[model samples]
Target chain A: MFRETTVNTALVAILVAVPLVAQAAGEPFIITLATKVAIFAMAGVGLNIALGYGGLVSFGHAAFFGIGGYAAGILASHAQSYTPLMTWPFAIGGTQQMLIIWPVALAASGIAALVIGALSLRTSGVYFIMITLAFAQMVFYFAVSWPAYGGEDGLPIYVRDKFPGLNTLDPLQFFAVAFACFLLAVLVSVVLSRSRFGLALQGARQNVERVRAVGIDPYRLRLVAFVISGMITGLAGALYADLNRFVSPSMLSWQTSGEIMVFVILGGVGRHFGPLAGAALFILLEHELGSVSEYWQFLLGLLLLLVVLFAHGGLIGVLTRRPHRD
Target chain B: MTDPVLEIRKLTKRFGALTVSDGIDFDLRPGEIHALIGPNGAGKSTLIKQICGELHPDAGAILFSGRDLAGEGSVARARRGLARTFQVSSVAPEFTALQNVVLAVQGASGATFRFLRPALGDAALTGPARAFMERVGLSGRENVPASILSHGERRRLELAMALAMEPRVFLLDEPMAGLGPEGSQEMTAILSDLRHEAPILLVEHDMDAVFTLADRISVLVYGRIIATGTVDEIRANAEVQSAYLGDDA
Candidate 1:
């Protein structure tokens, strides 16, 4: 317990401290990168709930991520344009509040997850992966064709959304928000993995028949896990849009789903701080290695191969001496 | 007579040209181990599956606690107090024996949807789970992962998990499948004690264990119940001898 905590705490501390040190040295760009790492890690954390614990290899989670991005983008646009989202249904208007947009993003993505999960979970293995990827593609195409929001060109937020007390435009302040969301996602993941629902989810992942024989409906458990996972990823999407000040169909693309999967795999699937570590290593590699060569992704592929071939549990597993009990 | 805890009537199943379960009728009265003995292709597993709602019978009625279980899924049947152990030892391989039993206890407790609270720390679940593990002779191996346990231990863990469900009927399929002499003897003793708690629909190959623990013995051949009677009665029957018991009789 102590060793695991020490490792996880060190990772969190370094993630939090490195950006602070960079910001102190007037290198705000490093802080921005840190914010990206935090946001993307949150996204990985979301996917881990379903993929890691529930054993759902959702190749289309970019749907939830992109939906969240759009939620942030569209809402902030309406708030900027001084246009009401809907005049009917009691005159609903858009707000630039981060608190409001986060919940809305979560709801939108969660509903999307419910619909997709309801259908996709009916199948398993390669078929399940394909169905999820297909659903994500459908969303990607819809986003591209919806010209009202710039279509393939994508929507942009004129200004970052406002937090209650912080200047979200300030890179440091925004990093704090992203970090808090990261921590919240981590806490939720940890709490969930120890809960009855989480136990059932993990059990279903291990053996669906055994879970069913125990009188717990594996489908319902998985669906709920998927929905929750989508909501967390969706919240991260909202943060990502604010960070980039853009929401594009690219965000909903299959590539985005693969990147999120990379984060989980690179750190350690189902490990507590796996996403955070994975995201940090990923961003560092992309930044440091991209500056060195255009073939940085090739190096990444090599690293991932080594990890998969040697480190069955990913980076954390390689780093930690003992295997983590799920 | 009072209604049996579990009753099957005219159960029939056909897989293309073969009839796996052919118009079978059976019942389990409360607190009696009714053993079903049959040869390899005689459809014992198929019948167990049909009873456990894993397979749908082409024609039949399965009444549990006098309620007809038609179109009910395995999970629904399990929730309705019909628990089962597999022919092969099956438990959550990654989980500890305690965690596996705790999951079962949580299911039986009807609070599986409760999130936020740590199930590992829940005395309500872990307490009963520990008790069930102890009852199955797995007290010291509570923290051991099910995968690392020996085959007999895994079988015991299966029983522990089934016990945690607080089942009213146990449809155990070959609970003694891979046991050695000592393990089989221990399993026979455990099952003999289990029958008094809830009637078991035991399907077994071990003649010694079956003859020792079975409150009533039923011989199945080609999906048909050829005979149902006491141990002496089944032993005395010439047809049972020639068809099944053979030189052992």
Candidate 2:
């Protein structure tokens, strides 16, 4: 039945979307939405690792995403500059190269995640959320004040970052690439969740005291999951920077962080494809609502409140499984 | 005895002027059924907590296998083969009985971090877990979540979890607290069988079950051991007759 819920949701999405995809085959708007789904899905997948699997309620993952994006953006800019690659210590040059950027993005976000996770995990429940938000704000304000790399104005790439032979400027090709990465992320998540460590992690979330009583440390298991979560989200940030050809402090804002969490909740917390479905619905809602009114955010908030108070389980609840009562 | 599995010397615990476990000394021998009986709030649960490293004694020495165990955490205590079942069942209600037991077995099997491989297929651990469940006559209910099981089944599942750890000593807290007549019978029978494996420290309210099963009885009252001996010694003791066991005696 647990497996059935996952399969059912996946089936419904495929069954429902074939016709729409056919209609929007060559349309630019369709391509944009597809990319949005990919991007948001990647970010949601990252949040799922911590929130869904590890039972951590972090509200500042946008900071990790934004850090990764900044790493990619800054490095690409440095590689093209006339100034030496780096001044102090060993000379370090930036790269427009995807190879170098991916690792940097991952490392930057991973380290940021590590610091934030270590501090936040020290406290439980509401305090963890507040501390993560505070740390993300610190990063956001730093981005705003720093005069380098366009500061609050943001940094823009004259040319999109390169990935070997692929001409990433081709919209379809880029979207396909993002989609492929998203699929890989999902596959990894499935494998990890079913793994033994995954069981222990889930067990810790369900009954931490019992887990400890049987000789498994919940904190250590959660720390590893958090790092992996950050790494995956950071990878998404790099892709996002390339897609927009820009990096801004706004990407790291607390609101952006909340949006990622909202996407997870919409997908259904603790669900496999819940995040993916949630991301699609969230972006679609925003796109459709934006056309109706400039003040669509107010309407969106109202709708979300209704959904939280009523639906609770998000899109996954309506489309797939009931809440786990046990 | 020189090789007693667990030795507690002058253990003390306080909750703001109320000394719950006051300077108590206890020892558990190998493969013995030791029963602790008392009214509510007599520090029975507190004693289990101190042994399992949940609550450290304000001042005492907890010697496991003749090794001084102070400052070791719960997991460490468990790895040293000291395990306990919560007074209120603390099992994963969402997981099947077999799955719950396997988690405990998996925990004791050392590293469970073999990612990218299905852990359910690990015959080494799950097989043993299944066997333990079968022993408790839960073979038919292996696939059902613990939440849906009867009160007795949940208690049995709790025992299976602690058993899967392969501990030398088990600290069972009220294994039959909420069971019906049938549940108490089933749980007591299971407890009887469990005594064959390792030394058990049972905290229970059922006087009939306790007197029937306990090889040695220890009555705890007001954070101190009121008496400790065979059933006859407890029944005959003057103070203990008034303090406890009067109705049954």
Q: Write the per-residue lDDT of candidate 1 for residues A172-290, one digit (tens) a residue.
A: 99999999999999999999999999999999999889999999999999999999999999999999999999999999999999999999999998887888889999999999999
lDDT of 2 by residue, A60-131 (tens): 898999998999889888877745557788888788888788888989999998888887888889998899
Model 2 DockQ class: medium
Over B158-211, each residue of candidate 2 has an lDDT whose tens digit, in order, gives 888888898889899998889988888888888898877889998988988898
Question: How well docked is model 1, in DockQ terms?
Answer: 0.88
Question: Measured against the native two-chain assembly using Cα atoms, what DockQ does each of the candidate structures obtain, in the order listed?
Answer: 0.88, 0.70
Model 1 Cα displacement at B28 (Å)? 1.0
Q: Model 1, B78-143: lDDT tens per residue? A: 988888999998889999989999999998887899889999999999999998888878899989
Residue A148, candidate 2: Cα error in Å is 1.9
Question: Looking at candidate 2, what is the lDDT of residue A29?
Answer: 56
Candidate 1 - CAPRI tier?
high
